[model samples]
Target: MDAAMFSIGNSSSASDNETVVIASNEDLYSYAERVVAAVICSIICIFGSIGNSLVIIAVLLSRKLHTPPNVFVVSLATADLLTSLFLIWDVVALLSSDGWPLPNAKWLCTMTSFVIFVCIGTSLSNLAAISLNRYILITKPYRTYQRIYSPVNIGLMVIFTWICPNLLSLLLSLTKIVGFGYNRKYFICCHFGQQPEDELLFILSDVLLIFIVLVVVVLSYIFVLKHVRQHFKGKRRREVQGIVMQASTSGNDTERQDRQRSTTAENSISQPDPSGQPIRRRENYKDLQVTKNLLLVVVVFFVCFLPYSFLIIFPRSDSFHLYAILLALMNSCVNPVIYARRHPHFKIVLSAMIKCQYQNIPEPTGIAKRFFSRGINPIL
Candidate 1:
């Protein structure tokens, strides 16, 4: 998309660009390169589709996964699923041996591009939402977290993540501001607006969107880091002060008192604290672990997505642009590895699905229960 946008928005002569584009398509990706590209896209699409489906299905079926954050995970999976489905068509268009397999179905290709763009945009939005959720959960009061991440609010956020992309893409297309269509430059469907000024504005807007997402994600993690560091620092300081006071008081004690003190210390270490501090510490530990896991998701997301966004600003060779597109598409595939393979309940349930271990599994309620209610249902 960025490649097409750059090629289309360039001030060069259209005819010259077309000649160069057509020549470059044949020259750039040879038969071997094309096959490799196809294999990569196929893997991304197949695994991405299946993995994300498992995530959604796991959440739907497993009562344990019905958390506020998993709502974001499902939303993310939904976006990736649409992306994985569209990518097969995307690669087919770009890698076709014949010029455009469907000569008469240009609109179909355009629609596919639109869906791809929207789904990708939605993925970014969902990531941003997840970052915000993490920030609130880590830094805010328990009641405040509960209030903000309540089911009604989560539903609204899921709605926002999906709706925001659709609206933005529609605005671009309806206004003819960010033209997304066939780019002969790389034999890929991408952007090039009719009006240069409008295209420039669209580019600026896209940059701003990228900037916003970056800011939200970066700042959220930064704040979480600060909070965690300060919390542990204060805790260590208090422990040090307590030790100092204890030593000062014990300095006047006899050898028998010292022996008794050592015994008391061992006993205290062995016994669990009756105070709520241990429980609070445990909660903090759990939150920190969760934050780290989601941080992995965010890191993978940016690694997959940033190159494409960078290429948009600094337009590169056809090969680089294609590489960027592939990397961006891969963002969809990598999330499920984080969610399904790494997430606790998600791993268990998805592993069960893989092993066909439904017999011992407690009957899940809602969708899975209904779907599996009648043996060999017609929907199967």
Candidate 2:
């Protein structure tokens, strides 16, 4: 892991002043700025690595978290981990120097740029897969369990997400088109070139990819919210009806007693009241609500990814520096926080991981085991 970190760190600062970025000529001042950037990057990379590493470990060790969605989450964390260690670390190193001091080679620079870009793309792709998964589960229930939990299907989706972006980045890198003109003033590594068309292609591909993912994510949440609201609303009504029925029954019983005491001349046998009607409506409603709440995972995906979309696509000379970096870095920190917030079980799991007091919880049955009793299900 340390080796991998160093390799990526070495790659990050491979490019310098030749990229045509914001200009700053002061040597000492530049050194201070680069130091600060490295510190920030190190902090983010260290914590991000620890958190994502825990996710992978917990999923592997604890049978409970090894579900289809967690599978994608593992991928997401893996991609982010690579980006922070490799690209962000490089950026930190470059902020001080005008250019890469190490051996400069065409292939090295190209490979470094390619690797860093792919890592970013992979993160977005995994998120998109997650959103699509949630959408299917909520919107199309009959097929959800069958298609979603299949190991074959899940594996393919993961592979597709990982592979597609590198292919896209390869095409972009080959063009030798620099998108954003020199941004030497603030940071380094993977800064776009001056060619508007090249930059536009890169931006379009990124936006298109992210935009699709965000759309699916947002739409999934919207459906989830609608379903939950209707369900809870029905539950509230049923609860009220139940109370009214109890009151009415008590009143009837009292009246019957009063009649019997007042006029014993006509004794009447009483029959048991019919069984209370089944609360099928309420049960269905509750199911919908629970399903919707689960879809919050998709919401997290959108929130983590949105800033990068807006910042990258719309480059501005007057852009805010800290804000841009924050938006990018937020993607690194958001996942663990979201998992902790939304999944109560995950909080306990994450805490256990942090304290190094991991317990052996029996693996929850796989999704397929729960729903598919006898036969294999196909998902294409």
Give me the candidate number with maximum lDDT: 1
Candidate 1 residue lDDT tens string, 35-147: 77777888998999988887887777778777788888898899899888877776777678745678888777777778888887887898899888888776665677899
Q: What is the C-alpha lDDT of each candidate?
A: 0.71, 0.55
lDDT of 1 at 123: 79
Name the runs in model 2 displaced over 4 angstroms: 1-31, 88-92, 105-109, 177-187, 251-308, 311-315, 318-323, 340-342, 360-380
- Model 2 lDDT tens row, 9-101: 222444343232323324223566557666767767777776667666656555667667678889988887776566553554355354443
Candidate 1 regions off by >4 Å? 1-20, 193-199, 241-282, 359-363, 366-380
TM-score of each: 0.82, 0.70
